[model samples]
Target chain A: MATAATSDIKWWAGGRSPFNMEYGKLMMWYFLMSDAFTFGAFLISYGTIRFSQNYWPDPNHVFNAFPFAGHANLPLAFVSLMTFILIISSVTMVLAVHAGHHMDRKGVIKWMIWTIVGGIAFLSCQAWEWTHLITGHHPVLIDGVVQEIGTTVSRNPWGPDVTGMMHDGMQVTKTGPVAFGGYFFGITGFHGFHVLSGVVINIIMLIMTLNGTFDRRGHYQMIEKAGLYWHFVDLVWVFVFLCFYLI
Target chain B: MQHSSNTHSPEVTFHHAPGDSASTIKKIVRTTVILSVITLIELALGFGIYMLHKNPDPSHALILFIKGVIVILSLLKAFYIVGVFMHLGDEVKNMIMTIVVPLMLFIWFIAAFLWDGNAWRNLRNTDAGHRPAKQEQVTKPVDAKKPGGIE
Candidate 1:
């Protein structure tokens, strides 16, 4: 049975797959749907906490530093780079999938390499950002004492300046809500972990292509499946970027 | 592969169409450009919000409006990513529904949680929202040593 009875036969009969798609692809879609819920819960909770708080720290103030730009504030520059890298990677993955459909082994290899490279580049940028935030200390006024604090899960030193205080020619503020750091690291870290795994999966796909696995199977549907997964990672980042960086 | 009246059963032979290479490439390029442009607009809007914050007296309503626009643009980006890049649009109607229908829960999920969160804040402000407070701690004794409750 094929699509010949496209309108004649019953689709929900389930004798064969009624989705008219491969079972593997359907399973991947289901998995991505579940993963979406996971991220949705995290972001929604962050929103809830934010609404509950009387005051929240502005993201631009906290994420104002750039790499090697000492004392110069440049908010959203690095993350914008990260976003572009991921989008480019997604485009390359699409190319890989397209080439896979043609069964052009060389084309698939070339694009897959570029896609993996983009993934690593994004990850490297994220690593630098995490290191910078974790290690960069700023002066904060705590209980009438000047203390240096870096952003962590338990501390946020980006609160409003109540007194006319100065340290290193910068206004020293009190600690803001502690949940800020926790959610920032937690969600972004989880997303980074997904990117890492996606890279690994792409690597495996690359090796399989080089080893003639798909050629032997006489189909490149596996690449299509992996492409779905790759694009899904990109999809999640859209929301992540909006929640963390934009609003 | 024809869509005439006498079509196959779409079971084991329902492979996706691989159109002319040129058209396929063109479609890919178009989607890529669209995705990039949307991202650039989103970045511009993000900068807009930052500029608003820099103003001495930022208009909260305007900021909210810009945020709403950004979110709508993000949804547009997401649609391109999922529908074109992931080829979800090429899937069967039932398949797309299967994927999208479950996602509707997020609307309720977000609404309920944020509603409860805001309600919790109101409750705490009104002394747990149950009964009047005792005379003991209605107004705290102002601390002479610590102003603005630092730390």
Candidate 2:
């Protein structure tokens, strides 16, 4: 299938033969790949800190959902719902891109709108979680005495008792050097910023869709590109959830 | 060719416009459900582990093995989400490897660090055979005449 021709012979202009993609889009993917590695580094550090510690608290206990009045310990319920919302949004986005492929402007707009809504909902849930954490919703007693109350600081179990004797559960907390919190806030906060930005980006794309930008061009490539970015954001959250909430 | 280019230029033309395809919809839903079930199972295991044995000796081989399994299963779930839902499955083999390999290596590096750090913590906390140096100096025999003495 190597049909040699003048266009195929071009160095910079022709991408179909060698890369099967335009330089611009390919570069975006490349950047995403690298960024993914950076996020992976942060998550790995978190894992190491958790593992190195003796009695690290369970993520479910640390991140219980807050309903109307008192807080409830649903662990992954809110996050799981948020995960599905993002996934559904990704589906709609892909469909929108597909519609764009067929020059179906209305379909693109509709799906893009749905995708935007889902992104907003995700951001909203995250914002709520962050607010709750910052507000010191959960309380735990430190050691067998001092009561240290905060979102990040807790007397949650991370190690066994000093003696071989066991109580209700391992009562030690504060794993590693206690600097893990700084890393946790910085990494997860940066990732959350990306999710927030993604929501804004999708909103802008939705506006463009409504204005018939893609309709006139008869291509859905831009939508596909945005979908790629959105999916990556979701993928990062998958690891974040595991790092912050589970492992 | 120029005329055809203009017709689609500065805009994209749809060859097979996007819409809700039932097959794809079904696939996505199926994947989500499956992922959810796997996560639920993980939660169940976590709870079960917590209930059965909260303080098994930190150096127990079985406990470490179970923890390893949990971590591996979690990574597997994460991989499925990225590969299937994120379209990495459709990417070139090299590109896929490029994304996955570094991630694995970095996690391993972190795991090593955590293992050493935890061991250090355990050593520092353990008070093995330390007759308290001056235990008798600090301990005073309870006097029945004292106001707060246990009767």
Candidate 3:
């Protein structure tokens, strides 16, 4: 009694996907893949410029300052702490997703709250680092005149003097090259913006969870999507840390 | 006790309770701990090398080796995050390929651009790439007669 059309229909032509993934989740992965390219380009550019220069800033000397350390040389200590915090936050985010799958609303909320806290903490550390860098002075001697310098789009306290010139009695003092600051600010600023956006998205997800939105739907796929974004941000940081801090 | 006929309908269904087994939770904790430990080791190695070298100029091979280790550690961390945390490991093979193949192109793009950028850097300092321009001094004379009789 079955119709020929119904009996002969192909699985590929059906509404269900053979890949066993929802359309939204697959799209999220694709988007993250593209975003990874953007980060990759920025990092590759950094590597190119760094190798091209005669001297690049030593990350150890540049990032030595630590909170309340009174200028003690604890090279890369602060940034390492920041990295740990971000990694822990990534752990919490994954835990939240796991909880979501189990339909444990309370567990999801708890872990998500921890992840948001970690994001804010990381941002705060970055703000402090930037403020310290901007406000600190670097003394440079040009033409027998002592001039103080700070970070700018074209110059960085971390790099050799880019604007120094020789004269009849001119003296030159250099900190770091101009390209270092340009690339540092450009790359880190871009990453910071991503973290900010991630935080905002997490906040929205938190509010929705509180309102029982996902509970009503009897699923928490939304948490999984947000976790994907949060994890991507963390993933980018791994590369950033290697390029900017370790290398 | 007597059961109602409606309660015995074949269409009746119940939702499965949501949660993970204890072993899964343990596995998540183990992964997190491993990641943290790796990060710690990286920090120690980085700082230790810097401290031990002391000189601004260290041997090129040593520096290159250290950098290689750092990059390897970073890639490992990235792998763990993407594989387990992102649940890509659990997805079907085709779905995984759908994401991984395009990412291979991303890596190629970085490699290609970096090689080209290095070539540009070398060319930038050459005579054919750079030409100096003449300029006039624009500073005002300090000995102008009207300036308080030259102070």
Candidate 4:
């Protein structure tokens, strides 16, 4: 019955859409929507494995180190800084899009440069973190022997000391379960790849802007599309931060 | 330089002018400031909880409440980014729903998977038919090492 009454609305009558969006932009939105699901699945699996364990490593212990802090016990401070950088980059991307809307070519270029710099800064920070995690901190004396601890698919230094019985007077520290490090590397590595690709795309867009390709077309729809992709990347990081760092 | 050859070209239509209004610029600045402030608050709350909590191992309820708050705040940031930065807020209702309604399935998928995975874990641990000897061997060492047992 309600459907019959709604037939009077001309836009719903379906000859043309009232949503004034281009075909390309709408398609990009649909693509991002699907990509979001891929990230969602990764995070959900991480949560499942983490909660099912008897003793999961606490996030505070795992992510305490920050750049130049010299091993200060700052829980999640580095990631919080990363989050701020990504958000600021998103802001710059949007400002570029806004400038595009106004046909301000120089504004677009400037803001896009800032966005690219932000992406590079973020990637460098991630590199530092990965280096620190892979190499690990100072060695600890376990059962009368100094053992160097680090992160790997099978073990991590953060969790309970899973060192098993000494064989021939050699101590064996078992560390955490295999799944913890596996998920940590897999999820964050995937996200880092996304950031890398976003940087490359932004560079291409920046070059085209300089050459006046968009100006010749008399529209900056390309910039808008790039902004959508950049913002989606930022959105995914928000959830990743919660899954890996906070929860 | 090619005006003579381009004289017959069709006139191009532009969607926006060469510059934005002052009010539009102001709005952009305001949104940026708001986003930065929210992020700062989230950082403060997270570190504050860890620093101020009396117990080294906080109560389960307390941790759960703090986790809930953090999740809500992060979602708020997502909302602002999608709505303002992506320009979806000004879009028509039908267009907005086209992106939003389908995404709800993502949350549903996560919830369903977590529940099923938890059940599998429980079954694997308790049901002898599922694991029998292997499960016993794997859990025995860890169970023995748990607190309140001989270290």
Question: Which portions of model 3 show Cα errors greater than 4 Å?
Answer: A1-11, A160-172, B1-19, B124-151
| Model 4 ranges with Cα > 4 A deviation | A1-18, A137-146, A161-174, B1-20, B52-54, B124-151
Interface RMSD after interface superposition, model 2:
5.6
For candidate 4, the TM-score is: 0.80
Provide the lowest-lDDT 10-residue window in model 2 chain B. Answer: B10-19
Task: At residue B55, give the lDDT of candidate 3.
Answer: 71
Per-residue CA lDDT of candidate 3, range A1-247, in tens? 1222333434356565556456677788999998998888888888877766667777887788998998688898999989989999998998898788777889999999999999999999999888777776666664467567777667665545446454334333565678887788788889999999999999999999999998887678789899999999999998899899887
Better of 3 and 4 by TM-score: 3
lDDT, residue A63, candidate 3: 85
Chain B TM-score of candidate number 1: 0.74
* Candidate 2 lDDT, B1-151, residue by residue in tens: 1223223432211111122567666766687777777667666655544444546544456555655666777777767766666566755455567566766676567767777667666665687433367545667699977899978
Which candidate, 2 or 3, has the higher lDDT? 3
Clash number for every model?
10, 19, 6, 1
TM-score ranking of the models: 1, 3, 4, 2
- lDDT per residue for candidate 4 within A164-226, as digits (tens), equals 644435344445666878888888888989899999999999999999998897767889899
Question: Better model by TM-score, 2 or 3?
Answer: 3
Q: What is the lDDT of residue A185 in candidate 1?
A: 96
> Between which residue pairs do clashes occur in model 1?
A2-B8, A2-B9, A2-B10, A3-B8, A3-B9, A3-B10, A4-B7, A4-B8, A4-B9, A5-B8
i-RMSD values for every candidate model = 4.2, 5.6, 9.1, 8.3
